[model samples]
Target: MSTDTNAIGLHTSTATQLAEHLNILLANYQTFYMNARGYHWNVKGNQFFELHVKFEETYTDLLTKVDEIAERILTLGHEPMHAYSDYARVATIKEDTHVSDGTTCVKGLLAGYKSLIELQREILSVASDADDEGTASLVGDYIREQEKTVWMLSAYLG
Candidate 1:
């Protein structure tokens, strides 16, 4: 195993850990994006237009973020896992099935947002330990976005 000092340079253990964490984050984001898309397509009842539009915006933001996080992993000298199968395996956020209502969808998405926040916190700790200030900053940005999404989704439930 490479020492922390050596890893601090180019090909470090930190990079590898970050790469794995990034893959997990990518998968979570992809799942969230698809779930949001599903909600956008199937939302019904009173607040349909509002919920649909909001879900679309959330998914679109996630779509961009997924790409950015993957690219960042590649920039760190690691290959970003791109296969859907791989994402399904790595993601902590489970796939949604049989979502029947807007409220249910919102609840699921709120859970996902919370999951993402937890994942980002772990990644942030890893980045901080590795002295990867850039990754830490990126994780912070993601945390803010996820928290805001969760708050908005939860508000709809109240």
Candidate 2:
């Protein structure tokens, strides 16, 4: 693939790389969504109501993001990975097997959010290098959201 000399034009290779990164992001989003849903359903103790509602909101937003990320990958001319098997292979976030307390769940979510933010940072760097302004913008927005979520979850643990 040839590199575009124009600062505003994306190179073909960059576009392909962005697509791959988006696919991984999509998978992670699914994993996070499912985990959030699990926490929403199984969360117990005095903070159940608040944490349940928050987890529902987080999972719903992540569901929307999953679609958006997949669409973005399509826009970049790559097929989005859509199966559980595919997600399991690509996602950096792993599912929890046991239901834990609200505090434990919050801690777990914070760790996952941090991992996701790191992955997004790497993808953003590649997007910037490729001159894929659209992808870079998307990653930037996503990083902010993830960072906020991380902060909120961490605060819950304190």
Candidate 3:
């Protein structure tokens, strides 16, 4: 290993930086996941059943992402932020206020996904620079997956 590199072959400072970005992502995902769950249970409209199922599927996926992100943080030799207060503090995505309306919930989900994809893109660039293939690959996949979801959800709204 190089003098500056960590056990995983990534530069130690870059690993720490990536961990910070991942922690921010983890917090946002946690809050967004909860908002999706709320949307799942409370959504109402002619499209109620379809949206409810969609929100459930969304939250379930977000929950899994949350776990994966935290694990990635640990892999970088850092601790994941666990408290709701910390999540609220660092997350750029706000809690969903228009919960019960299908249109509003979908809008909120899209906005949240936009924030996530933006952050993940930043991390992907940093990870690529550091030669941290694990982090790069993780965020790269998420960006691809979310970009598709964004297009599909926008079509749903139209």
Candidate 4:
């Protein structure tokens, strides 16, 4: 590791920035996952079966991403934020409620993905500048996956 960076080969300041952004991403994923769970539990209509399964899958993926992000922060030699209060303060995505309607749930998901993608792009730029390939690659993968999800959800809403 370089003198300017931590043991993990990331610049100390850059690691700090990455950890902060990752925490924000984690918060958003948590909120999105919870919303999906709510949607899965409460959604009612002719499209119930399809949407229910879809929401379950979506939340499961989000849960996995949440863990990955927190672990990434640890790899960067920083502590991951855990409290809901901290999440609320740092997260751009707001917690949604009572969205039982399938269309409304899908729209909410699209909006959340919009916020998440923008943040991830910002992180990607920072990671690139810092030569943090791990963070850059992680954010890149998320962007690709989420862009496809956005496209699908948009088509669903259409």
In terms of lDDT, which candidate is stronger, 3 or 4?
3
TM-score of each candidate? 0.91, 0.90, 0.96, 0.96
Pairs that clash in candidate 1: 7-12
What clash pairs does model 2 have?
Answer: none
**Candidate 4 colliding pairs:** none
RMSD of each: 2.8, 2.8, 1.1, 1.0
TM-score of predicted structure 1: 0.91
**C-alpha lDDT values of all predictions:** 0.85, 0.83, 0.93, 0.90
Residue lDDT tens for model 2, 56-119: 8888888888888888887787789989999999899999657759887787778778877898
User: Per-residue alpha-carbon lDDT of model 1 for 28-101, expressed as tens digits?
Assistant: 99988888888888889887888888888889988999989998898787888888999898888988976748
lDDT string for model 3 (104-129, tens) is 99999999999999999999999999
Candidates 1 and 3 compared: the better one by TM-score is 3
By summed lDDT, the worst window of 10 consecutive residues in model 2 runs over 1-10
| Candidate 1 Cα errors over 4 Å, as ranges | 1-11
